[model samples]
Structures are given as structure tokens and as C-alpha cells.
Target: MTATHTYDVAVSWIGDRGTGTSGYRAYDRAHDVDAPGRPTIAGSADPAFRGDPARWNPEQLLVASVSQCHLLWYLHLCSAAGVVVTAYADAAVGTMVETADGGGHFTEVLLRPRVTVSEPGMVAAAVALHAAAHEKCFIANSVNFPVRHAPTVTAGA
Candidate 1:
């Protein structure tokens, strides 16, 4: 059965600093991302846009969202395919190019997943499943840019 999924998040800007938007540099881009039962995420614009360096930015979150999607789907597929996973880690990267108008779009996102399986024989199957996971990832499919994976599997003792 096909089912629709939905998510809700509340973003409240808290950078008023007394005088709100008095000038370009007068207000900060600080904000908080919240959801029921979840801790607040301190968020801001990219540092290039005069945002706080300590806070999470939209670009980083976008990359993380797609990376998380791939990780979850890959684990499920591996389990179903009888490849026992012992460890999984990913260092996902995204590239975006800005236009003359100060707007930009993500050109692509690359997922580098390092996985360890219980048996040496499971390496090939584990590597192959990354393609299936990418194809099924909802976040990856929603983006206009391509989401690709370069997965490496190792046997863990």
C-alpha cells in the first residue's frame, strides 16, 4: 500500500537584537528549528551571508537530509538481502554554485558510505545495495540535482 508521509518543523527567528532589520548588518540570522519531542537546532545562514559560524546552515542541513535518507535505506536493504552490517558511516558532500543574482542551487550531492559487514563474502552484495538505496531515497529523489553514492564495504571480524 502507498502512503503519504509528512513532516512539520517550526523555525522562529530570534535575532531581533532590539532593533529589527534596521540595516543589512543590523540583524543576525540566528534562529531555532523545533519539532515535537526534539531538541532545538540552532540555525543560521551560511557564514558567507553574515551568519553565525556556530549554528547549522540550510546548505549543511540539505546535504545531511539526503545523506541520512541514503543511510537508512541502505541498512534496510542490506538486512533484507542477508548482508549483516556491523558498522556504517558516511561523509556526504554537496556542491552549489551561486549566480550573479546572489542565488544558488545545489549542483549535486555525493554520498560516501563506509560500511562493515560481519562476513567477507557480504562485501559485494553490500556495495551493490547502495544503488538500490539511492533509487529509493525520498529526499534524494525530491531534489533536482543528482544524488550519487560511492560505497566501500569491509569485512569486520
Candidate 2:
């Protein structure tokens, strides 16, 4: 049997410069994302869209969600499979293409995870688990674009 889960977030626009969007350039593309019992996440559009470069953007957050989901699942699988992970890091990249009409969609996301394991003998299994983890990632499975994995494993010192 399948179980269902629900998630909620509240996004409030804080970009109004008093005039309330009289023109495209009149307002800042800034907002805040809030969830119960969690810290508020400051968000904005990508800098290319006249948003603040210092604040987190929706595209960056989406990519980060995908990466974070995979990492969590990968760690859980590693623990269950007896693969001791000493360190884990990922440089994930996503590509989005904009249409002529000013709309865009992500084409793909590449997860480059560099993992350090407790033993050299566990390298193969550690690398192999990334595919399984990707298969199990809820964010990756839900996305319309492809989510590819390029994992590297090394023995820890």
C-alpha cells in the first residue's frame, strides 16, 4: 500500500517599493519563504530577472532541494548497506532554457557527488548506491527533466 504525505510553505512578496508594481522595473523581485518551526528563507528571482544577487533565488533553491534530497537518501541507504561514509559533498548543476515568450523550464540537473568512505573496499558499493539513491529521490522522480548522477568515491584518511 502507498502512503501520502503533505508539505506546506508560505511565500510572501516583500518587494513592493510602496507603489505596488506600477511597472516591471518599479518593484524588487524579493520575497520570503516560511514554514512552521523553520527559519524564514529569503528568496528572489534570478539576478538576470532584476533580482538581488545576494539573496537565494527560486532556481537555486529548486536545484538545492534536488541535491539535498539525493544526499539524505544516499546517506540513509549507505547506513543501511553498511557503507560507512566519512564525508560527502556534491556540486550539483541544473540547466534551464527560456522560451521566446519569457517562460522557461529546467532541461536537466547533474549531481556530482564526491564521497569519501571508510574503506577502499567499499568504493564500488558506495558508487553504486548513488544510482539507487537517485532512483529513490522524491524530488528527482517528480521533476519533468532528467536528473543525472556522476559520483566519485574515495577512501578516507
Give candidate 1 misplaced runs (Cα > 4 Å): none
Which digits, one per residue and each the tens of the lDDT, describe model 2 over residues 103-152? 99999999999999999999999999999999999999999999999999
lDDT (10s digit) by residue, model 1, range 1-157: 9998788999999999888999999999999999999999999999999999999999999999999999999999999999999999999999999999989999999999899999999999999999999889999889999888888899998
lDDT of 2 at 45: 92
**For model 1, what is the error of residue 133's alpha carbon versus the real structure, in angstroms, after optimal superposition?**
0.3
* Candidate 2 worst ten-residue window by lDDT: 148-157
Residue 112 shift from truth in candidate 2, angstroms: 0.7
Q: Candidate 1: give the clashing pairs.
A: none
Error of 2 at 86 (Å): 0.7
lDDT winner: 2
How many steric clashes does model 1 contain? 0
